[model samples]
Target: MGKKINKSSQNGYHHNNHFSNPRSKTKSTIVGGKYIYHGEVTVEELAGALNISSADILKYLLLNKGFYNINSTLDDEIIGEICLNYGFDFEKEDIVEADDFEHYKIEDKAEDLIERAPVVTIMGHVDHGKTTLIDTIRNSNIAAKEAGAITQEIGAYQKTINGKKITFIDTPGHEAFSAMRQRGAQVTDIVVLVVAADDGIMPQTVEAINHAKAANVPIIVAINKIDKPGANIDKVMSSLSKYDLLPEEWGGDTIVKPISAKQNIGVDELLENVLLVAEMRELKANPKRPASGTVIEASLDKKVGSKATLLIQNGTLHVGDYLVIGTCYCKVRRMTNEFNKPVNAATPSTPVSVTGIDGIPQAGDQFYCFHSEKEARAIALKRAQKLVNKQAKNEGVSILNLHDKLESGEITILNLIVKADTNGSLEAACSQLKKLQVDTVQLKIIHSAIGDVNEGDVILASASQAIIVAFNVHENSLALAKAKELNVEIRNYDIIYNMTEEITEAMKGHLKPTFIDVTYGHAEVLQLFKASKVGIICGSRVTDGTIKRTSKVKVYRKNNVIFEGNLASLKRGKDDVMSVKEGFECGIVIDGFNHDGDIEIGDIIESWGQEVEKK
Candidate 1:
């Protein structure tokens, strides 16, 4: 074993015999009072430069930093410290790694740039005629095919207007699909915010405006339902002005068009305006370069395997091109247009349904084409490893670590999802949470609604890195399980004071974990009976998981929690039982609920338990 040297006293080794001696055949040289090293230096190369044996350097590092082999490359910091010990400054040749193909910055010459169609995204509240507008423009009946006439997923389509092509991305309008809407905004160059003339501006309409603003894109308001009897264009325009989207007629740059999507009234003018804006922006891309763009959407088909919809932003994409998308690599076997027509190649702003992806790439993930399969595969493997490492490092932000994260500049915004038993409570909770913002961090409520926390909430929280605050409302079984799987934090609180106080303390880095409610199962009341001995009994059918007699029960009427207490009795077919599994009918009685009409049919009875969350 060699003698270990203290890292703090490393400079004292300058006059030692190991470094003072000169070794032949060394590549390093000292000039202008600095030791110049070329490229990355290995342990053996460093030892040779110091005129010392490689074993001494390895032993010293093993005793201090970590073990290293003779051939292992030394980091710049280690090389610098070692050079300082030899009475010289250090300088290494700058070595650049392989070009980051995924994030490669392409600067196309003006001569090589050609005009490309503008990518437009349609966003608005539900039932605002957004899909109808797209259907009218594209001459497709996609709205009729959707379940409940609501677009559940993102759909990309291409339409030609006056000899010019335009790409349209139709995003879901429901509040639950906020993540999808956000993704749509990011990849769009222009946003067509459709506001229902009858409904004016709604919650999702405001959300769409904010998303578009955050994306720093131009907005064109399409006031739909003008042909309806209740249409009010002026009211809608005035509402838009409140969001700082003033119409051109009102001395602002925003273009407002009155269109009846169902009647096809003023639809032609909307397309005209889209083209006009595209021309003004001078959208251009070089189609001669290798293809690179974002994945609009992806899915797994039972017959075709993994298929993805790619929006080629620049360069031309061919059928046989090798692509590395996120962590998946694939050789494009086939490509189809939005209408499912076979296409040989796609240019900028073209949306194509591509097949042969090894794995499903997430929506909004960027993809780049490579010349060789080996290079694409290697890049994909490295990306997959990086993703695994990142996931391991991300523990999912929670209130307990909010202050620490803010102080460390890890995050500047705290996103929250608020759920409450009633509209009043939801409003109050959101207000209090917003007021908890400090100077260093901002609090944004991405979604707020009245109901038990559900799977949709957990999914949104996971996507947005947000925490769910349940006020007087608990998460359902499915939501609780999904939250754990996604590492989403759902904080439950019944008292407004405690909720605000604890959040304040958390913002100040003083909060601690307490007992949290755990949901066991839920059952729906099928019938109500007036029991002579029990006062009132609920004939219920277990809908999910298992309900036990010892678990505490809460009465939920229309997604609102109304009562909470221990169960009076649990019976099956007039016989007492300890537990009832899912899909089984049983009799339930609340200990404190005595009125015969208190528990009504169609109401939900939730069984829950509590456990302490240790620090």
Candidate 2:
């Protein structure tokens, strides 16, 4: 039943008929021939008021207003559009109230605003000169210290250029650190997207662009590696245009500067452009108020206890300040700057690492200082209780009921970690999985790499509530045990078609039994023994579980699988054996692998079997 308005009155409506009210029982007032709904309203509730099916509302929104679920709250513009089609008008009533934690929002006057250093984030694909560019600017050899020359964590530093300071955030360009890069973008005032001139565009580069755009920050494109062979600045510029990042010289607003980070060519010009953009943004903050900032990174130090690197967005953070971050409260004991120098206070846009955190605050958690330790502790306790209550009410995202969750507006993004056998397979699998995004739910590949799943992958997936998708890749023993302990799902598939098909069906809530490789045990190659009949037999030690003679085995050298075949023979001390348990030495011979140098010492041999599980 539709609510009827008073046709006799041109300005308002009179409540009439007992069946007119919607299921929510919220009374609506008609003004200017439009219904005024109070507070938040869902699509189903609005549909019920309009005497229309919720499916119809969802279809209308999908076609005209983009993707939205049935329970999604309607914004003002969307509600107005829907009201137009339903032969009526609608308006939303705003309700505002102040709570105990309202001190977080400081309304500073125009006179209080002062210029602060612009926080810049360097982002690009792996080995694309992101770190090198920062190294050149800071005159430090930070990149050389990283493992494999790839940054593993977020690094914050400050550089002075022409008497003006600029804060820089060096985010890992690797695909596995997408979440870290996203956090960097959120706190940055400007994003310097580094694209290698020799290598036009890569997958991670596109991801960086998306992250910068999502943060609603301006981008300055730096065409790096210009001194290298095959440097094509024009090609890189053309590729940037495809992502809507047109160069200023090409009649666009985005500023593009060509620079060779290693040679320091055009580095000065790049810095000038960054400062010019910062000037145009006119970034300002009131440093007189209490400190409010975001945690860039946090960790537990064995010697120092809990430490967190925080970026002061506004006001000043001083040593011995009481702060509440997330559910944790901290009394700042010591403060250190980017160069590890001790500091008494840090102003706006300054990154400082502080000790005395009671608990490890997560990256991207907002922290605000309180006048006293009592206030901070009280707020932290209340937040902890609130978090516990929220967790009790909500369930973690699971692939089995993904469609149901989307329909109920519980989650709109399905996070996944993809692992493949090679670079080509990894790229292909990621590209294919990205197409599964639909009107109601989006598939987000937070991490992707070419290798077997490890314990680190399981930990990240558990923290992000993501599923692990392995394409023609094995799961190591530690990763498998961790996944089971954490209740993480690892779906393995040899065929790309089957992987996509099953995931598609699961997204629609049509889950089926999935076959996953169950690892039996892991063994290390010790010494090579020349067997007369079996050729080279590996004198090995079973490091985990149990290795059977009938099980399939994969020979791994430096974490890469080189051979896959059935076990030819299993022996223990010159005696034939059916299996060998952990901490036991055994002789293993592959059915087909017999090369002398192929099965070297220290190589890992993994035994596994396929098992089907119901989703």
Pairs of residues at least 3 apart in sequence or in different chains that clash in candidate 2? none
How much does candidate 1 score in TM-score? Answer: 0.64
Best candidate according to TM-score = 1
Please give the lDDT score for candidate 1.
Answer: 0.78
RMSD of each: 19.1, 19.9
Model 1 spans > 4 angstroms off: 1-101, 145-148, 173-185, 200-218, 238-254, 276-282, 301-304, 421-423, 433-439, 445-449, 452-465, 476-482, 510-615
Score candidate 2 by lDDT: 0.77
Model 1 clash pairs are none
Using lDDT, give the best candidate's number.
1
C-alpha lDDT values of all predictions: 0.78, 0.77
Cα shift from native, residue 5, model 1 (Å): 40
User: What's each prediction's clash count?
Assistant: 0, 0
For model 2, the stretches where C-alpha displacement exceeds 4 angstroms are: 1-111, 125-127, 140-153, 162-164, 172-185, 198-218, 238-254, 276-282, 299-306, 340-342, 359-362, 381-396, 408-614
lDDT of 1 by residue, 1-615 (tens): 011112232222121111112123344667787877754578778887677787778777767766455655676878887778667788874422221344335566677688999999998888898898998998889899989998888889999899999999997743323354333324688999999998899866776775566446799999999998898999888888977899999999999999999999999999999999999999998787667788878999999999999999887889888888878888899999987999999989999999998899888677877655766677687677556544534566787777877787767778788889887888888888877755666788777777899876776676667788998988999998978776788988988889888777877888766889888899999988886877888889999998977677889998999998677778999777778999999998886685867888899999988755732
